[model samples]
Target: MTDPARSTVDLFAPDVAAEPYPVYRELRDAGPVVYLEKLGAYALTRYVDVRSALRDWETFGSAEGTAFNPAMNQNVQGVILTAEPPEHGALRSALLERLRLSSVRELAAWIQESADAMVVPLVDKGEFDVVTELARPFPAKIVGELIGLPPELTERFVLGSDAVFAAMGPMNARTEQALGVIADVLTTIGGITAADLAPGSMGEALYRAAERGEIPPEHVVKLLWNYAGPAFDTTIHAISNLIWALARDPAQFDVLREDPDLVPNAVDEGLRYEPTIQIWGRFCRTDVSFDGVVLPGGSRVAVLFGAANRDERHYPEPDRFDVGRNARDHLAFGYGMHRCTGASLAHLEIASVVRALTTRVRGLELGETRRHLNHTVRGFERLEVRLS
Candidate 1:
């Protein structure tokens, strides 16, 4: 019998947002769904509940926007994420056809190449801000170009990407500043053309889809948000922390250097242990029953993905960062219909970087790093790393 009114599980609470694991454990252990009056949202503390809500999109409508932002109604125009099926399926399919895993494999070498070129010089320097130098710029520029964005427009990509990702968080100074920048960025992408999309890339394909009426035209710009947004921020966050992860324990670094093939598993385990994207939101379209509690219609449900990844019920001693953890089914990339479309791409990108660092960079250690200030994302603002 736990009270939800004064519960520590409210993510909007400043302290909880900064550090939520203790609260997550409390909610998960006490019950399946915790009714939170303050967040005006329900908390899904268990893995099963989170999985079900993601799958049950019809019941958990994305049209109204997932977060508590009532303004998201006007703000979410044309983004495939806000559109329900037929339209959602069409837009998702069109974008998927472009960024499919098969397409990702085609760029694996390119990904490795990019990582090597960027990481080598930095590793040689022995120290650099992992966020500004590597994590932020590298992905912002590289992915922006690969997706058919021109070089001159890289600044828009960088600024907008920050805005959209930060917008995922609750209202705050960081989130406020980012929202204005993202609106402009989306407008720029929205103005681009299929011809300008740089033939055959995901961005170009999305415009083509819009023209073919495969997906809504408004959704095209959002595709940038959906595809590049997840791909860029999450990977950068993981890479930055990954250095933190391995460098924190030299034994682990030694293990990775000894065997390069473990890159994929190692990356997956890192995702599970310290996922960059901590929480994703969904809204109950109608009354939904789970854990013997009924989440009435219009309830805001905050799925504590960070908590689920560390759930001792699903994973043994989830706190430990064992590279061998069987995290295949982990919800780090989410689950069901909305599972991250860029999953393969992210893995390939991260794995390549991971392999390159272990093989090429001899010694690596953390110089300094700061957690990104945001309402949603939990990653580096600046990660200074020293490597030989």
Candidate 2:
């Protein structure tokens, strides 16, 4: 038997965030559950353990703050991200009816336009801050246009998204800052009318669904808030992440350069390699035992997406960055009832830019990278790159 005194959260010490895989491997080998005193919860580290819990909401609840340890964060409530059951189903249906793959397809023209505007300007500069000038601004505009906001609102969406992601942690300084940003974003976004929204994007579609009595118009309040704030951070981070992967290893870059068709595979592999959102939490409604470890009822459990993606049991040679690794089953997007509703739209957007970059740029080099730290979407503050 293992030592009952030593715990596992130490493996997540500040420096450990810089490289979390070793800790994850140790935890997986130790057992399915590890009690983290700092975060005050049990953690599920292995593939089978986590997948089982995530799929069974009756046991692992979301309505009680999916990312906050119930033992720590006492104010957890049911947002669309945390709610389970008939409640989650209704809200999610309202969201997906508007965010369907068909609607995603319809937005292609707008996505193409937004992407083109960002790329064309830097083609000649040869050296530009990819995150600020490209990734940050590009998704900001895409989200703004979709929501039917004035130019000023889009500007806030950029800053507000930064804050919202940062606030998804302990009620620290980041939480305070994110709360202010979220308030401003909600005020700005909630002011939106049918006239303000674009005719065919997800934001506008939600308003339409409301008119049909699918969802009360007031619900559109959080709906649009989610559209701009939550979506932007993840997508922007993904963009910078993909570029980072290529810059780190030219063999991978060369692979994409040689065969543009490999861009999608490369993008998925990049997500698996460096998931910007490292960890998420859920509440356990009942005491459960797995692999001989027991977690008490109402305990919190954090599922480290980045660590789990790198789990050697599910992925062989997990450290290798192959553009053609066939990452079809990757969990970068959470699985089960809460699987990302925007999966299709996100795929199209990432795929489009990857294909475009592969076709156009002969050489892409990074000059400097700035990381914007958030509790959740921790990624680029600014990434400078030169394309030739």
Candidate 3:
């Protein structure tokens, strides 16, 4: 078979990370599987190929760890993100006790109330920075309360979550710095005991699960890390990006306002249009062929979630931001068993923000924005807006 297409795409470059859709389009156009020369990894840019790889986790194993760098891969071992088979299921089961759809649905009323409490005042203010005022604090509050994290420690965890994703990239200066932050965050988490957590909180529940032998006591901290690290960054970015999308397209916000029932669809479309997670790593366990292109054993494969979500072949008029579009199939939360355990919670949080905005704000006026560049995630660090 002909050699797989190769591209010199520097996905981690500041410029590329700032505005990656054009590069995503280029990667998708390259082929089903393109070799990324700079990273020494193969990229699955097409929706079909990406979905297939994510689904067939046995071939594209997570056991070796999902991050590109060896240190991160080793660091993430045994967590749900890296575990395979029976161990993965057991770990996931414990997590789902609180994160399942029914459980998440039960929290909707409180989530909506929290969103209103945070957003209504911001709306009344007329102008605010979406990142600091709404997006960041909203999730930080919700997740913090749920996890029983002390209010003072919330910001550190949020910063640590960013570091977690940042460290997943190549061992560059950024990754090195992120590693230091992660080490500090881990140390902080290690200090917490069952007594330190709030009664009936998710963090406390994890400790209880360990006590009951549902999961090992040793797994409690790593499981807590799983909950804390992922719960903020992706949802925070999603909320900000969704609002940014609506701000950029008033017509879409209008569409959402006309049909409040479309809030879930709006969230999905927003995730598809600009996935917070741009890429994730998978190690090829053995020689695997995708559309006649062979990925040799022991290869590092980059699963381009952002690219697949925007693949024109999978999403018609992929670039357009339509709140009514049914894009829930998007890879933003990934696919298959390894899909994000907190997806239900994320949807609830994002939908809560949408409901609050559509109810209270007539329109949104976009202002200056800045991108939050990280190795694997894409989002705005500062997003200013005026609500009318």
Model 3's number of clashes is 0
- TM-score winner among the candidates? 3
Expressed as tens digits, the lDDT of each residue in 18-65 for candidate 3 is 888899898888777789999999998899999899999899998888
Q: Any runs in candidate 1 off by more than 4 Å, and if so which?
A: 1-15, 172-174, 194-196, 207-225
Q: Which candidate's lDDT is highest?
A: 3
Worst ten in a row by lDDT for model 2: 69-78
RMSD to true structure for each model, in Å: 2.6, 2.8, 1.0
Candidate models: Cα lDDT each = 0.73, 0.72, 0.90
* Candidate 3 ranges with C-alpha deviation above 4 Å: none
What C-alpha lDDT, on a 0 to 100 scale, does residue 34 get in candidate 3?
86
lDDT of 1 by residue, 103-140 (tens): 77888888889888887787777778877877776666
RMSD of candidate 2 to the truth, in angstroms, is 2.8
Per-residue lDDT tens digits for candidate 2, residues 1-388, read 2321225465334456655678777777766677876767677776667778888878887777765522223323435776667888887876677578987888877776667667876877778887877777776776666666667767888777777656666666657777777777768876778777778766788888899997788878777766665677788888888887787777778888898778778878978887767777788888787765677787877777776778788889987878889987777777788877767766667766666676667778878876666666646777888787
Clashing pairs in 3: none
Instruction: Using TM-score, rank the candidates from best to worst.
Output: 3, 1, 2
Candidate 2 ranges beyond 4 A from true positions: 1-14, 69-78, 208-214
lDDT score for residue 318 of model 3 = 92
